[model samples]
Target: MTTTRLPLFPLNTVLFPGLVLPLNVFEPRYRALMADLLELPEDGPRPFGVVAIRDGHEVAPSAVGLPETGKPPELAAGSGFARDDPRRSFHEVGCVADASTIRERPDEEGYEVLATGTTRFRLVSVTAEGPYLTAEVEPLEEVAGEGAGALASGVLRAFRSYQKVLAGANERSLAPGQDLPDDPSVVSYLVAAATMLYTPDKQRLLQAKDTATRLAEELRILRQETAVIGKLPSVPGAEFTVRPTSLN
Candidate 1:
């Protein structure tokens, strides 16, 4: 796989492909990243890398203070102030997302946008020359000869179940006839990317390369959620705890 240099954003959350994540880009480094992206050529896919901050805060630097006493001496050389800075580094595995739609909010906090993930990439190296973080990335490809029909079918089934669960919980009617792609990879990508579950689960889906494996994982999650929903209370608006006598 060929490696490409991309702007990096280490966030507290993980983003999946086709998902709409609203981010507040008030931080100076990220603001610079967005500005740099806008300047890129319009024809090509302008991509960026997002990695979840595992140990430290993404907005600010770490609080380890100076070099530790018992730590490996070499670790201290590259490990103190740099660890605290958001722009200093990022995780290795990240997806390259296309900033499809962007709307600037009234204030300068940040722009709201929908990003679609196109490919999975691993961060090979990073350079901290400018305000934003930039890294060399290697794209991971899907397994060959994976049929689209089976994958799409599995994804569709899980998605339908997910929709049903959402409707049951929210007490809303299901939207009808949403068109899904026939290709398995596309289906898997879209469904996995658009889910509202926790970031770690989404990251797991993103990292799965084989179509069958991805579909299985998604199906498992769907079934678990469905089972959980079935066991929960059936009363609508029960979460609010309104008194029974107040309704009269």
Candidate 2:
């Protein structure tokens, strides 16, 4: 596998390849991370890694979603170095992302970073303790296997059922008619992103070594969640959530 040095961003969330991540960049350390990233050659993709904070803080007072997600409670918490807390550190596996746009925050106090997921990587070693974390990482991919046949179709059906149950449980979701990607790897990552799962659970999916194995896990999780939803009493006026579903 190929390896490269990547600047790191630790957050309270999990990111999946082919998904978009919007971040509130306010701390001085991360501000430096953003600046260094901007200096990279624009001729090719400039990507950074995002690893879930297993025990530490995001190192920024702000961890806002896009304007639509509203402000989460964590945004209001304290900001500091991620490693200041004795128990804080990042997970070893993470996704690399390419920033599509970086704009100054409306208040002009910080910046908003909008990035699309590019690839996944596993940390080989830490090269920088911080201004922000940096590390050597090996790129990861699903073990190449045949795709898009009966196994895939069954997985797709399970995903649909999972989404239906999830929409009923939640208040909103992506729209219909648009279909899932035929690439098994892409579908697995996309489904991992959309599913309501714990950060560790999502991380487990991220570390899966093969698309076929990931699909099996995805189908199992979807079925498990769906069955849980199946036993719940129906809401009188509940509707399937609808918005654009395609991550691409």
What is the lDDT of every predicted structure here? 0.59, 0.68
Per-residue lDDT of 1-248 in model 2, one digit per residue for the tens?
A: 68998887777778888988877776666667787877887566768887777766653344653334333223212243343442246677889999877777786556788899888888786544456667788998657455534556667788787666655345334444557887777878877887767778888888887777777887888788677666667732233322222221
How well does candidate 2 score on lDDT at residue 50? 79
Regions of candidate 2 where Cα sits further than 4 Å from its true position? 65-88, 146-149, 235-248
Local accuracy of candidate 1 as per-residue lDDT tens digits, 83-147:
44433444446777786655554755445555666677877776666666677888887762455
TM-score of 1: 0.71
What's the lDDT for residue 63 in model 1?
A: 16
The residue pairs that clash in candidate 2, if any, are: 174-243, 175-243
Residue 195, candidate 2: Cα error in Å is: 0.8
